[model samples]
Target: MSAKLTFLGHSGFLIDDGATTLAIDPFLTGNPKATMSAEEVRCQFIALTHGHADHMGDALAIARRNDANVIAAFEICNYFEEKGHGNVNPGNPGGRIDTEFGWVALTQAFHSSSFEGRYMGMPCGVVAHIGDKTIYHLGDTTIFRDLELIGEIYRPDLVLVPIGDRFTMGPELATRAAEMIGAPRAVPIHYDTWAPIEQDPAQFAPQGVEVEVMQPGDTLQLD
Candidate 1:
């Protein structure tokens, strides 16, 4: 089986493996760079890496509308459950949630996780395995050496890197992260969506890795 990954701007992505569709960090509602509306988002599962507003954008509404299973950290899932969304799978760093499509695993991320002053659990990078392909979505975080270990274990086909500075790694650091992960291909995210984090995608260059700078709504086919 094959899968299609569509960039939803920032760190959001829609991965569809023909039968199941999964949404990751879907922050489309108020996202200026988003090409699609929340109502247009259709998925059977939604995975969130953190509780930041931008990262959890429209997840509640989208999950309710689609009756999608929400996969996130323990605190995040509890929050959704309290709001009446019962279909939730909660896991923390070093934990993996099994699903029909395959599985979703959480990895430690060097960042904070909170929304409206409430602690939302640890921020994390998402490693998703679907359609016989693995995708590593490195949620908002600074450069860390453990990325190399993650790459060796999951062997992701594609890696989503954050090059938006201030809150996350800039192009220079992200470039090194790409090298450490050693993924064959990577996509730059978490930038160009706002002024504070604005960055030139071309600046991210990692040796021996192919970087695909995708615009919002751009789709990449993965085998």
Candidate 2:
């Protein structure tokens, strides 16, 4: 079997690559459109792209319960570590950290970072190589030119993009982002979770790119 990636609603996902389970931006608890809860999640590594409450949802609880390594920006890690999380892997943009599963490389994201008014660190995107595939999760950000550079360097097979306009890129911009990254396949996330960010995934169409509109409980197999 290849790797199984389950969409945990919003920007959250669980990737089981036979050897390791990596969870990214698991914001299920207070997510209005979420179909799952943090209690049901089990992963070896938890990767947070930013410091928003929605993006950081249930990470501490799930990490504490599963003894998973929480990976995020430097200050974000410190925040969680001080909050009693036993394991924390701090990282920064333009750097890569190798892990048992594979590797996670940080990239520049055009966004802000803060949690409850506390500084969390620079918001960044993530390039994760797990199981048999490579995924580029473009955290919460507007369209930027660096995405092309990331794609050129990593050559991710699948890409996850945020299509929510108020806080991130809208469908039109996200479609352009897909073209810039040149990934074979892409998934639309971080949309339809609230009123301001609500978007229709079908409306986003990038030429020569296959867009996967994943539901809250859907899973995608990549090998």
After superposition, candidate 1 runs with Cα above 4 Å error: none
**Which model scores highest in TM-score?**
1
Worst 10 residues of 1 by lDDT: 89-98
- Candidate-wise lDDT, in order: 0.96, 0.91
Off by over 4 Å in 2: none
How do the residues 33-57 of candidate 1 rate in per-residue lDDT, one tens digit apiece? 9999999999999999999999999
lDDT of 1 at 21: 100
Give the TM-score comparing model 1 with the true structure, all chains together. Answer: 0.99
Cα displacement (angstroms), candidate 2, residue 8, comes to 0.7
lDDT of 2 at 133: 86
Compute the lDDT of residue 105 as modeled in candidate 1. Answer: 96
